[model samples]
Target: MTNEPTIRSIIEQELERRGYSLSSFASRSGINRGTLSAILNGNPPKPIAIRQLDLMTEALEQPEGHFYPLYVNECVDSDQPNRRRVKAFLLRCAEVGQTECIQEVLDRIVENLSYIPMIFEIGEELYEKGLREESRLFYNVVIESEKYQHSERLAISHYRLFRLSLGDDAEANLIAATRFELYLYRLPEDYQLDGLLHLANAYLTLQKWVQTEIYSDELRNLAKMVYKNYERAYLQGKAFQFRAERNLVVYYGQGYVLKGIALQFQRRYEEIPEYIAGYADLSWFVGLNESGKEEVEKFKLFAKLNTYNLKVLLGDQSIIPEYIESVKKHPPEILPSLRVIVEASNIHNFFIDDILEQFNIDTGLYDRADNYYRLEVSKDRYLRLFYHLSVYYLRKKEFEEGISKILITLKIAISLKNYNYFMKLIPLFERYRSFATEGQLKEYETLLEGVIKDA
Candidate 1:
């Protein structure tokens, strides 16, 4: 199980066991010697075509399809149309982590390339199941397959792959962004607009401020193009799936939010409040009260909460009490995943006398921490929430809790490889060093030592 043999490895082993030199075997099997050599010796061994494999089977006096069963144990016969069954089988193989088998099976089915859509569908399912690495393989297969080079599926695959890499790998994000831009020219304006938004978002994450601004402007211009088309359609008394005016509002508002988010990362707190208000107004108009047209209430609430958090970070504590009351009044309106962030903001600023309510929020956050890892776009806020939790515990004179929270904060910061943030927390830990018990302090020191060793 630790090192299951690949098809090529097994073939090589079988050839050596039979005392046939590779050249002799290639001549006997009627495969070109160079192609056979490449198949056997390539860095990632190339897959054998079915006809070639069958010829090798005959030459080796092996049962027909012998090599295939050894490699793709659970793979079905290569039928082009049983896409649903193939999708299920591939997902089953992926679930067991049989990457080699999956690749081999896919190669065997390449002659029936109509199954590519099913493969992409399976990839989407795998992504939803949290199998990112496995899902990425499926997407890569579609990208590499020659038949799909000019296909519209290429755009869809590139976009999904980009989403998978966003916030997790900057280099991968850039590569995906490039593919999206390259493939998007063949697509419609809607797709181009979405592609621009993705590029802008990625550049924002990379702190490429000039590039981000450029893409943001492009997105705004594309929205105008789409709006003009919508107007023409409206003159003919036609309807679009999405309202053009609503889309216009969203695009302009998103431009503000995107710039605000980039500014937040740059620590330009002064410029954010206006953008936040604009985004909030548009979000409410299009999201909640727009004739029940859009389901964007969560976005609206997040924008509202973000404005409040920014105010706290900017030393506007006078609003903290009102903010806390509003959040409590509409608890259901807040996204469950963001409840912890909102409460953490309150804990960071306002002094809460209701210990039970605070405990409930903390426990709720603990139960939902898994969601935090999946929220890569909100990583900065996630890190800040933990930092504030640490400070909250310290302020409350809860030494064990404070130390534990700070340690978790450091671990997350380090995992992100944000060394600047990691370095910043070192001094904060030292600032609260006196609050910890001697034993706790020793544990903290040991943890920091490991960070140095591992880093």
Candidate 2:
């Protein structure tokens, strides 16, 4: 059977069907219009009081069961005190961005220590408001609370979200790396490998290559230990191969990148090739080489090939067109991956118009392709592409086009719920909005409102 209609969606549809504006419905139900609007259109509402649901239901002439079922489940399925209250408080905070209200709700959770997930949920909203300091403090409180049992896995998961929210802050990276290390050490042997991988990544973010190397080595050993344990599955061989490939791509390739960065920082040019070679070998092993043994090498090669074009600008001769030429001669079947490699390698510098012409790619297709790559790869890439495109259009005096692209980029960044990206894009938007029309300006305002409310 299908799930019940969401209370908020139901209210929204019912209000629309009844030809009542939000203001009219608010007056009839005696619910605050702003609060009601937020509940219906913003983040999920906190568990509502039965009486409040009853009032909303009675006023709308709808069955109370529709609105109260979820609330009843919250009460009966758990022993946690004030779960309903905490949920309500969180929803309200999300709607209004009221830090004080949010803090009060969080304070109650801290006092009881029963709703740990709710704390993380609220922390995400706080992060949206650019309140990293407050979010970090709350995360720590949740971590320390005795009432809620914390697990390394949960902490690591939450830390990933926290990292995304805070961007690349060195202090935050250090803290995450430290926590991951402690978690891995304390974790049971059978469960420690995943934690080690996370720890290694955190270290990589902090540019602590030595620490990352240690964790990566541990993870590699752990993977070897688990390799023979799963042999009976129907696709066991393929699954094992896939897992091994993931390790090679993530640990070996990524580790080499870190090592290269570390070597560069230390001015150890003599050792750079070894790290770069490791990176290149792994990339080729993962099918980044066109003549690789894999039948579908093209897709893998394009997807995995790293570009050192930036290195060229820095006077590094490590990445050369001859390497790419070798791949193109024995091209893989994956056209998209090929395109990705071409774009990523900054091959655009040599053949921007030619690549566009050869592919017969329309502007829309180019935009979509760029979006797909950015989404699949990294937000930094997304931002970089958007910035490039915006500047291109702006220089050509296509102000509207530039502003539209930036606005879309901003919306995407906000939707990913990454505050760093949002923060980076906001000022750009504000500066360019002057070129927008009245309707476009209003639309931008509406989008911002939605982001703020949902955030």
Winning model by lDDT: 1
What stretches of model 1 exceed 4 Å from their correct place? Answer: 1-101, 109-135, 147-152, 166-188, 192-221, 239-253, 265-270, 281-315, 330-361, 364-374, 377-379, 389-404, 415-417, 430-436, 449-455
TM-score of each candidate? 0.58, 0.41
What are the clashing pairs of model 1?
none
List, residue by residue over 1-455, the lDDT tens digit for candidate 2.
75876556676777888998978888888888887766666665554554566567778897534444344343333345566555664554444344554554455456654566667666656666776655664566666664424564355344534354434344555665565444455444444554565566565544466776677667656654453343333235444323222333344344455455445435455666665565454333322234333323323342244333234324433454444454344333223323333443342333233333344322323244323232222433444456445544555567898677667666655654545556766787687777887876887888889976874
Off by over 4 Å in 2: 1-85, 88-92, 95-99, 113-138, 147-150, 157-168, 175-180, 184-207, 222-253, 256-455
Report the lDDT tens digits of candidate 1 across residue range 173-216.
66767667677665556666666777887776555787787787
How far is each candidate from the true structure, as Cα RMSD in Å? Answer: 11.3, 14.1
By summed lDDT, the worst window of 10 consecutive residues in model 2 runs over 369-378
